[model samples]
Target: MRVLYCGDVVGRSGREVVIEKVPELRKSLKLDFVVVNGENAASGFGITEKITNSFYESGVDCIVLGNHSFDQKEIMNIMSSDKKLIRPVNYPEGTPGRGAAVFKTARGKSILIIQAMGRVFMDPLDDPFAAVDRLLNGNRLGSQHDFILVDLHAEATSEKMAMGHFCDGRASAVVGSHQHVPTADAMIFPGGTAYQTDAGMCGDYHSVIGMQKDEPLRRFTRKIPGGRFTPALGAATLCGILIETNDETGLATSIEPIRIGGHLKPTL
Candidate 1:
């Protein structure tokens, strides 16, 4: 199984790049599945049904959410209905959407996608490790599912790497998001699981982490909020990781970083 996990999509530029590239990538790479983090898709706050549909139409198979999962109120209306959409698993019990789902590819192979949020310097959610363990316990890789991918939406690199190691040999890949900056470290773990500290944001890198520089700079240097942070409207760099998993073992055989357009140096 080959899967492409895109980083957080921020606002219009991010969405545009993803929409423009997913189809071409799916064909050129022979991708079986495409998952995108849409937490910041709605003007860098949250995702909406319309935007999610656009992504689906453009060849995205599933979409994941992070800390800002519910910034857009309308998400709740379609959360349960949209099986392709998932939120952080560690969220409270009553959260509308699910944290994990098993989706099949055109070849009828199962792929389990699980998402969890870390607590360190982040929302005081339930234990992410325990939350993910419960899901992995029942769905064994190479048995119940052909592949398993865990998206640890976290703030701390340590937390992300810990999750990767914790799920080693169990999941096909463990990738991080939310930092908005791509890390250089992309490698397969000793246990055969692919790992990356972060896949980076799919938005203009010229701004401060995909936001217009003025407000972030104001809050940083002046220590005051002049205005709300806005998404940078410049050309975006689509960032993500591509992983190919062994069919019989359900472990990653290769992992590669992907960066296209915008300011970051291109890689594939």
Candidate 2:
């Protein structure tokens, strides 16, 4: 199975790149499944219903959310309607949307996607470790599910790495998000699971984590909010990780980093 995991989609540039490239990538990369982090898809804040559907039409298999999951007030309704849209598993119980889901490919192969947010320097949520363990407990990866993708939407590198090691051999891939900056560590673990500290953002890199540089620079240098942060309209660099996994073993055989379009050197 070949899966492509895209990091946070920040805004217009991010959405546009994904919409334009995914279909082409699906064919060129021979991708069987695609997951995108869309927390910041709507103007660098949260995702909207129309934006979500646009992504689906453009070839996204599933969409994941982070701390900014509910920024768009209407997403709550879409979550109840769309099972392919996932929230963080560690969110408090009774949260409207599901945190994980089992989706299938065109060939009927099962792929389980579970998202968990870390507590370090983040919102107070349930134990991410326990949430991940609960999902992987008896759901044997190779036997029960053809592939398993664990998305650690975290801020700290240690937390993301810990999750990868914790789910080693249990999941097909463990990737990080939220920082919107791709890391150099893209490798398959000894247990065969693919890992990357961050897949980066599909937005203009000339800005601060996808937002326009002005406000961020002002806040950083002046220590005061002068204006709202907006998405950078410049050309974007789509960033993500692609993994090739063994079908029978349901473990990653290879891992590759992807960065293309604007700013960052192309890694397609």
Candidate 3:
């Protein structure tokens, strides 16, 4: 199975880039499935139902949320009805949306995509490892599902890497998001699971982590609350990873980092 997991989509730049690039990538890469982290798609805060629908229409099979999962309150209205929309698994028991779901490709193969939020330097939610363990233990990778993808929306790189190693040999790929900066390390683990510290944000990189530089810089250098942080209006660099899993073992055979447009060096 070939899958592409995009990083957090910040704002208009991120949304435009994704809407423009996904269809082309899907055809060129021959992707069987696509998932995107959309926690920051709404003016750099949260995503809405409209944005989610745009993604689906543009070829996104599933959408995952992170720390700002509910920033756009309107999403909760359709959270229960939208099977393709996923939130952090560790979010309390009564969280609006699901954390994991099974999606079937055109070829009739099933892939389980799970999203978990890390507690280290993040929200004091449930233990991510424990939450993931329950799901991983319940699902038989090669038998019940053709592939399993875990998206750890975390702040600490250590936590992300730990999750990757923890789920080694069990999931087809373990990718991280929320940092908004693409890491150079993209490799398959010893156990055949693909790992990347961060897939980066599909937003303009010219600013401070996809935000307009003025506010972030003002807060950083002067340490005073000036105004709300907004997304950079420049063209965005779509960042993500493409993973190809073995059909029989349901393990990753290859992993590749992708960066296109904007300031980052193009990987294509």
- lDDT order, best first, reads 1, 3, 2
User: How do the residues 95-171 of candidate 1 rate in per-residue lDDT, one tens digit apiece?
Assistant: 89999999989999999999999999999999999999999898999989999999999999999999999999999
* Candidate 1 vs 2: which has more lDDT: 1
Which number leads on lDDT? Answer: 1
What lDDT score goes with residue 48 in model 2? 93
TM-score of each model, in listed order: 0.99, 0.99, 0.99
Q: Rate the local accuracy (lDDT) of all candidates.
A: 0.96, 0.94, 0.95
Cα RMSD, model 3: 0.7
Q: Tens digits of per-residue lDDT for model 3 on 1-268?
A: 9999999998999999999999999999999999999999999998999999999999999999999988888988988899999999999988788999999999999999999999989989999999999999999889999999999999999999999999999999999999999898999999999999999999999999999999988988999989899899998999999999999999999999999999999996
Residue pairs in collision within model 1: none
Q: All predictions: root-mean-square deviation over Cα?
A: 0.5, 0.7, 0.7
Predict model 1's lDDT versus the native: 0.96
Clashes (candidate 2): 0
